[model samples]
Target: MSWDPYATLGLGRTATADDIRRAYRKLAKELHPDVRPGDKAAEERFKRATAAFNLLSDPALKSRYDRGEIDADGNERMAFGGGGPRPRQSARAGAGAGGFGGGPQGGPAGGADAFDLGDIFSDLFGPGFSGGGRGYGRMRGRDIRFTLDIDFLDAVNGAKRRVSLAEGRTLDVAIPAGVESGQVLRLKNQGGPGVQGGPSGDALVELNVRPHAFFRREGQDIHMDLNISLTEAVEGGRVQAPTPSGPVSLSIPAGSNTGKVLRLKGKGVGGQGDQFVRLLVMLPEVPDEELKRFVKKWPKRDQAPPRPS
Candidate 1:
């Protein structure tokens, strides 16, 4: 898709170089791939945003684009009279070796289209006797790859970022939500220049998401550990638990044990995965003298013993 550079950068046609740089930097911080890695949508936006910025960042290119010589996507428009601004000649030169009456080959008078074709071929290949040779060599630019690392929360919520190229150029990337690792983002014609007027290659950005301390992702679900005291587990009460959205209250059933799992629905990334709270019973390292005495004097008369069949 053709994107308007000025509109993408939030600037006018008359914006200065300094203004463009500042705007790019500001948007880059929020949309860079490093800030929202593993997000496919965000990566696509980043590519488009950077492509727009790259086209507008160069003064000469921007001028040419503004003058209607090229489109926003950097495609040269066909000028008037066919290829360029050059003028065409009349049909006399194209006639079959004679005047309008007749030709040496006994054919009708050649039209302007024949003359134009001859002119184009003569300009391109230097007046060949006949058509037996191919024209132009193939030249392709090198492909560029960018690796971006994003924070866990930013990957989930989406963010913007800036990436600095080897040539000292910076790109503004917009990261979208719900991206995954190893996703490739392609920016067409944004790579190295062609050797002999051939089209440029592309820039590819790969995504990498950072790990979260509290949240462990399983597919789309998020898992977390919830610590509950012995009293709360025995009495069954509402306890606050940590989730990606924030802390939420969870009901602990009476007589709950360690390793018990409580599920909180729609609390994961994109609100599609369930948040599992794995209960961990934390025991005090040191016990008081009274507690020790009570534990020592506890009755076990009703306790049942294991029987083997």
Candidate 2:
């Protein structure tokens, strides 16, 4: 029977990372082996819970599993199933893919339907291999895993990455939009060649998104501190701020203070998340004497109970 992590964890395809984590944690607490000693069902459920959580925890693995690229255990499934893309099977009586002429080892046995001893003997002592008490064909190719380092900006705004292989070959990986660090990008039929004409494997590329100096991400949301002038903060106006899409005008509230967060909707990763801009007042390196004088000479307000600043 095939394994479905979603079924094991009682989740759906639309489950997010947080939802997965929450579900796994709840199941682990309930199905913990220690809590139900000597219960085989509990132990098995516990093991399955762990496996499902581990598989679905990684964004890349979850994505691949959802797309049916890989199985619950991270093994690649034949993309073309049910006789799809099969190497030419031997349908001849004696003339296999590389078998001999239709006849026995004692020359060509006469008859339109002669008994092909070669076919019989080959089946007896042929190259067919078995595993776990079951006969099977040649093994499929092995998947190759690579860790690719990409720029923060490139990660935010997806870009194409060319990976150089040892055999003087290159692979083009299409980094998807809003792809996070540690997410996998699976390239189909790009790994080592198939064994004895079996299906080729895949190339699993794990993305390593470099961190930006001023910008950081949480899920799809992006956060950054915007340096607003004192004048801009005092007098609310439209101010331009740098975003992944480019510089965008943001309206700052009048009398805004430090630590105020302004939201720019649909400006984050792939424009699906909101960009949070924290207002930070930047002071000039050289103090303005005129400004200081104005403050010094300004009328003082009555000392009242300080409200929330």
Q: Which tens-of-lDDT digit does each residue in 68-125 have in candidate 1?
A: 5445554433212111232112111111111111111111013321112223234444
- Residues 65-97, model 2: lDDT tens digits: 687555565444432112222222211111111
Per-model clash counts, in order, read: 16, 0
> In terms of TM-score, how similar is model 2 to the real structure?
0.56
After superposition, candidate 2 runs with Cα above 4 Å error: 1-137, 301-309
Stretches of model 1 off by over 4 angstroms after superposition: 1-141, 194-200, 300-309
lDDT of 2 at 208: 71
TM-score of each: 0.50, 0.56
Model 2 backbone overlap count: 0
The prediction achieving the highest TM-score against the true structure is 2
Q: Rate the local accuracy (lDDT) of all candidates.
A: 0.56, 0.61
